[model samples]
Target: MSDFLLDPDVVFLNHGSFGACPRSVFEEYQSWQLKLERQPVQFLQRELPELLADARRQLAQYLGARSHEVVFVPNPTFAANTIARCLSLGTGDEVLISDQEYGACRFAFQFAAQQKGFQVVEQSIPLPVESDEAIVEAFWQGVTKKTKLIFISHITSTTALTLPVAQICRRAREAGILTMIDGAHAPGQVDVNLGEIGADFYTATCHKWMCAPKGSGIFYAREDRQDLVEPLVVGWGWGKDKTFHRENEFVEHHEWLGTHDPSAYLTVPAAIAWHKQHFTAGVRQRSCDLARLAVDLASQIDGVHRVHADRFFRQMGLIDITSLQADPVELKKHLYDAYKIEVPVIRWQNRTLIRVSTHAYTSREDIQTFTFALQEAFNQRK
Candidate 1:
């Protein structure tokens, strides 16, 4: 509690939406900000290329990928927008995506599809997932002869369910279709090994679960797939340009985009270090335990029910609140205004869900507080 930058008065359980950084990582982020301000020209022009290279190297290693394959972006939305805009799609082309993907990413693809005269095919994946094999089969059912690419979430945002991306990637590869994964919630909460997952394009937010400052994310494109992407911002990286790092056209073209605060991107390694020092297996297990506890207690409440098996979630879990007969907005307000509990109540499709994200800063007492508040809210109506 003391180490995190989160407010002590609030029981902050919404780490899934925007992660809370530790004090150490936040300080490191500030130092980078100060360094950038000290000498803007020196930081941005002279030393930034090498600094970004080093930062990318560290991030690549953390993701089990090559340095050249990863570049820092402001957020996953930025990365998705870039990919979505550049995709060469026609009227017959289809992109198969999961029904549970984040809406922003889905919109990026949809917006692009509208421009290029393609279709965005969303596959329905029934909840309380049976097995990884079942998921692969169900998702694959949506793939058609026109399926050019597969877009899926590594971990769904609304449901807090971890999708089996590796299997999907493999099957996509076999079918000669490209795969793009939105891994916004995966990097810090789960062990992210890019090599093992083997998606053609993968993007993740460091701000969400990685505990990096807000507006930090990594975009990964496999070496072969890099040629498929066009730079979103036609910057100095485009056309006849002065090369900063001579690694590849991929890094040269995508790395620089005019000038923005690179502090969050540079602070990634510190966040990684913070995790290395404090996020032990037991600590991680405790967070998962608390997440499970939240779901269990919420389910025991008269009208709440667990969304999926415990195996479907890690560090974050979900419980359906449709039967609570309470408006999602009012329940969220009650949990926050009255109980000081900060949890996200999401309405996905027709089902109302309370997403519980437990992290290093969470405790059983926080779960109890939230559960009790939920109890009181429903009891009021009874």
Candidate 2:
């Protein structure tokens, strides 16, 4: 709670949308930017590699990944694009994904599939998922002999449910299919071990849950599978035979994506450190507890229900408000305009849901305020 840099006047219940950075981490990001501006040539050309490697080391230690296995990207969308575009899947090859994927990433695969003459099959995982086994079994039904890759979300963006990604990845590997996990919402909200998950490719955003700067994200490709992918952006690192051996095609392809702002990526270490210093396990537990409270309170309203059990969710929850007749867009505007509470009301799979994202910045009072505002909105509708 002490580490968050959110404003006092605003009740930010939308941490999953775009995470707020800690003041200390923001300062560190600014310092990196200032240093780069001080001597652009020295910073970008001379010192950037060392500084980037240092940041990668810290992040890798925190995430239980090898520094070389992970590279900085602007967001998961870019990371997913790199994998989607690079893989040489052709006609008859299928990329299996879930209906719960983020829209942008889904589009990335769709576009790739279209160009590659491959199929992007969206397998639906029904609501009120019974268990990890049930979810995996349901997804497995979509796999065909032609299936080339299994793409899944570690934590679904719209539903806020944590899928059993590790089990699915293991199964995919056994079947000789590649696995790519979109972990846009996982990193800081839950403990992630890329080695244990054993996915061929994984992508996550630091800005969403790690409280890093806007553009910070990490893309992890398994060492063996690294050779199969091509970088989305071709840059100076493409052919440069430097310190880390350009032999590893993955490292050479994705790391240096033209000259742009590397300040956010450099400041990821500060974000990781800030979380350790202030937002401890106890704080995370408190935030999750409050989020559950909000879900429970909101579900008490007639025509509203919790999307899933507490076990399925981490720090965020989805409330199904599909029974309400009011326009979801209008309801969202009314909440923000009249109540000053910022939250997301999404329409997913023909149902309208309100997703509440809780983080260290959230207080019990904030949940109460959201509950009160929701009650008012429901009452007015009635």
Highest lDDT, which number? 1
Candidate 2 lDDT at 243 equals 35
**Model 2 regions lying over 4 Å from their true place:** 240-248
Per-residue error (Å), model 2, residue 239: 2.2
What is the overall TM-score of model 2 with all chains considered together? 0.97
What TM-score number comes out for model 1?
Answer: 0.99
Tell me the whole-model lDDT of each prediction, alpha carbons only: 0.90, 0.89
Q: Which pairs in model 1 have colliding backbones? A: none
Q: Which 10-residue window of candidate 1 scores lowest in summed lDDT?
A: 237-246
Worst 10 residues of 2 by lDDT: 240-249
What is candidate 2's local distance difference test score? 0.89
